[model samples]
Target: MNQLSPNRPRASDQMWLDAALDLLVEAGVDAVKVMPLAKQLGLTRTGFYHHFRDREALLDAMIARWEDKNTGNLIDRCDAYAETICEAMFNLQDCWVDWDLFDAPLDNAIRHWARTDADLKQRLDQADNRRKTAIVAMFQRFGYEADDAEIRAMTILYTQAGYIAMEIAEAPADRIARVPAYVRLFTGQDPSRNEVERFRARHGF
Candidate 1:
């Protein structure tokens, strides 16, 4: 009974996922419904079925995307090569400034959504644990003791999470200027002038 043209492809899953994420970031999780998403994408509801089983499936995909980008990239940055803890701190700080590497708005939205959904909250907890554990390992690699590393890791994660939660707005140049002090405070060692310059250059400051 289907007469769809073979050449015309249906909307891809990423398109649906991106639309859902936009809605979620703008209006919260309740706004991420299938009809609204299909309408936003200018695609038929029938086409959505090809990519996701149901609304819940689409939401699960959103969470997976969030974890893949935010949590996964942070871990990758933590594992990136750095000669000193300060350099490693800069590597991790790259995520704080780069939206592509870490979607702060989506992260904040997910945290808000998790408050109402117990399953999501549990998954969020697991993600936090994984992030903190990786950060602790990064510190330990630079010769920090277990307790010291754990405290520093928690400080770094919690501080950035607070910034995301509060939605603080600071100019890029201003934030970059504070990097030296931040690195020093977080790592207990001041970054060299050259290290700070390199970090700024990497961010085009």
Candidate 2:
């Protein structure tokens, strides 16, 4: 069991949500009950009341956190300054390469949970559409027509999601070797040597 700060009166709302997310990732949504989390936090069940009204409230907060951190932050990074479509794609790649920023385990867990929950399935669908829209806008900024941009964006985003779902195990060397080709295939533009080097340096691959 994980313990909270010894000096604090109790855990914060975010702390509880973080613990819940950890359990969700490890044992699915069914394991994200208040009693287990309270036990993990070294607190009583009543302590959870200080933060969430009930399990549903906690679940709702978790989804909101996921949206803010994963969707909102990724979209913001995509909208950051990029002189070309390739650069914009690279900007998005920064999120993909850095698992810490994107939380792939949490993403996989939520997606699995959505398989049986209609409401959650709807939420996931909306998030996917929004993400694709952001990617399309990035291509449009590089002068691609709306239809072309949409198709390219879908291909890029879907391919990334497929990579995650497949859980392909490969040597880091092999994966790095494929980066240039992947960038070309996704963006329809060959990445410059400097761009590839910078990506390698950023990801240390």
Candidate 3:
């Protein structure tokens, strides 16, 4: 839908990043080389070079765009959903895991890159902090007094990351479908349905 398209002065930067992020999703980061982006966008290398200095510059641009769009914008959007802490936490977790926002191969590639790239890892750390802050706010609203926000946040993040990893594995859908139950356990929420509870216990989650 070209959702990242910016108005006027930022237009060229937006176009370049849209092409880069698209390429990253469709073909993986390694496939987002300058030549392919130019070809895909029907632009010459001269045009691309005008917007981005080089491949690393393009990735930096993409990371900036991601931080602005996902961490800054989307997190604010989450506050409009629920009132209480547990409800908000579950809802936010549910919203974040929506398939529309997740691309398994792209996710795997980003994690791989983060391992060796300190700059990208720093960016991820910022996003991670924002998420934890939001989650801690939710927990505080639920009457939890531990003040261990960072610990809770890291635990939740690790669980979500592990869940994504499990999804990418060869596990059958019937088994992987227990993710919601595991989510309930981690969030300390009681499942509304017997089936959900049964699923949690069955998975030892």
Candidate closest to the true structure, highest lDDT: 1
Query: Order of candidates by TM-score, top first?
Result: 1, 2, 3
Model 1 residue runs over 4 Å out of place are: 1-10
lDDT sort, best first: 1, 2, 3
Residue 158 displacement in candidate 1 (angstroms): 1.4
lDDT of candidate 2 over 2-42, digit per residue (tens)? 67677545678988998999999899998899988988878
Cα-lDDT of candidate 1: 0.93
Tell me the deviation in Å of residue 162 in model 2. Answer: 1.4
List per-candidate RMSD values in Å. 2.3, 3.4, 7.5
| TM-scores, each model vs. reference | 0.94, 0.89, 0.66
Off by over 4 Å in 2: 1-10, 170-177
Candidate 3 lDDT, 78-140, residue by residue in tens: 464554444455455443444343344445556666777887888787777886777666666
TM-score, candidate 3, is 0.66
Best by TM-score: 1
1 or 2, which is superior by TM-score? Answer: 1
- Tell me the deviation in Å of residue 107 in model 3: 4.1
* Worst window of 10 by summed lDDT in candidate 1: 2-11
